[model samples]
Target: MPTSSPIPANEFERVLDLIELDLDYTAQHESFEDLVKLAARVAGTEISLLNLIDSFTQWTISRHGMDMEQMPREDTVCQFTIMESDFLEVKNLMLDERFREKSYVAGDAALRYYFGVPLKTPNGYSIGALCMLDRVEHTLTPEKVELLKIIADEIVARLIMVQAINNLKYDLNEAKEVKKRVAHDIRGPIGGIIGLAQLISQRGEKNKLDDVLQFIKLIQKSGTSLLELADEILNTDVKSIQAAPELTEHELNLLVFKDKLEKLYLPQAKNKSISFLVNINPENGVVPFPKNKLLQITGNLISNAMKFTPVNGKVTVDLDLELKDNAKNLHIVVRDTGVGLDVPKMEAILNGTAASTDGTSGEQGYGFGLPLVKHLVDGLNGTLTVQSALGQGAIFDIKLPFN
Candidate 1:
């Protein structure tokens, strides 16, 4: 019944993927196990289930009125339910050819008025079903079928959200691993750069002094960029940012940001032969974000642009304001004319695979950029979207709550 191939054994990733199954439903969440109980009670049914179909079995992830944990794939009502596109209702299983001889339906208890809605993964993989069963023959009106889909949608959303959180945690761990290796490996070369630069500066002939100094400058620039990349990894925790002394409500400091960015990035950007254009929102009016948090998020976006984009490519940043109903928000977008993403990176992010990217010019990476952006956005109840067309460019858009 699974729409996609059974999750590969290696990809099952039980440590991070199955958090909800391992944790009790505290006050914060009503677990799927609880939803099963509620469903059976509401319909006055003999059984209900939140089940996931594996390669060879229909496993009841959570059960209320049923003792069976799973059944062979061929015996599953879920398999038949999956054959249809939407919620299904068989008011009387015994009367139909499909169910008349099915052992589970004809066994110790009768099953009638059966309804189930399929649950799909965020990336469009069909994973399982939420179903309710009753013993008495009955008809489900169109409205009831609609209601079942609505409830099923809620179930899908909660589970997918749980899975998304799990995937983010995986990304954070992978980023950390990349960070550790990068720090351990880069020190010797960085030290050699500084030492060689010093040797050349102190004793090189005047005619060659300019070349030596230029080499020193490039080393310094590379070292600084590497340091900033490491800093981005360490700053993933949003709570580490100091709260603004006073939350200012005025036009944002464009000149201050420009100055700060130039000081932080001029050498690295120049090394890459990249040009940066930072523009403020027309409204420019600021809200209540802690300035350091804003800087970390946007600065990492810029850092990635400089790191991965090809030489001489242009990276432009823009901001806009959105007022929806009673709330205001900020939409900041950074786009680069770079060597864009390939199919693999896009699919990997969508399917929650490992995170890593090599920089152009063989600059290498610590692999923390977008993951850090995503974590900070999650902390603030915001949104981040990454768009890229192979051979074209990449654009990142982040939405932050304003007021």
Candidate 2:
């Protein structure tokens, strides 16, 4: 009675796991099917398979002249093929001592001649085999065996290529999404600048001297904001910008916060003939925080106020300090008299679900400023409060604890 050789259970399982057979090979690809057909034609065999073995089963990713998709590993000659580095061949399965007792060899289908080229990966794992079988005994020429090895190499190359293509596709899609986000961030400031420029040009044409100077100032401020935003986008590294050495509270207090605020909001207020006021409580002078982050939070809030407030409206920014429960808190408030929000609009704006809308002077917005402010406030371990009524204007309050 003939008996089959022992299986290399450990090595087989390791190779199976490394290739990740199911993910790398699937019948959906026509290339695999074509490879099987070519193998059968070149080897002069009635049956051919691109086989992958996983533990207890031999799966045919692609097959020619076979109706079955899989079979027990114990019954298939391909199982023995995976254990060999080079191709395995049997001139007559029924005459071979190792395979004559195999059920398929003695029974109905009567698989006889066999030639299998082990599919080896670059990392040196023989995952499975590219095999050919016939019902009658036959000898494969040296040329035919070389052809089988060539086909196996092609199969492995194609699989690697597919993986590369999938990775490239994923990277391309990620790049597109980043581009959209950057563009969304950039559009708001640019739109505000353009609208302010148009206002300046119109005021100059009509000789509206009183507001013309204000519009010009606003254009300068918006232009500066736009330039800073461009720098941030180009660098694409917020951590690097925030990694600068921290400043003491007293040092930050003396760093011209009032001047920065005036430069940011005064022009926008003047462009619309709106009253703009900034009151800093001198006693609540310095607080330790990242200057860039604080500037972003305040700048975005003030810019938003300028965008939403109407002509002859009022926008007030107040900075003060409060001692509560022995913990000092910095309170920043921006209040604007303009079209106010209802409940849903306020929620969407805070939650980043709101779509950007044009401001009172046909100004364009990307609806990203408030969400960015919300993110910054969260990072600072602060609280944000919004109070508004339809046509009654709105107020944004932020409270941050001193470090």
Q: Which numbered prediction scores highest in lDDT against the true structure?
A: 2
Runs of candidate 1 exceeding 4 Å displacement: 1-31, 120-126, 139-143, 178-403
Query: Residue 390 lDDT in model 2?
Result: 91
Q: If scored against the real structure, what TM-score would every candidate get?
A: 0.38, 0.50
Please tell me which predicted candidate would have the highest TM-score against the true structure. Answer: 2
lDDT by residue (295-331, candidate 2, tens digit) is: 5577667767877888888889888777544355778
* lDDT tens per residue, model 1, 194-219: 77777776775753857776776778
Worst 10 residues of 2 by lDDT: 237-246
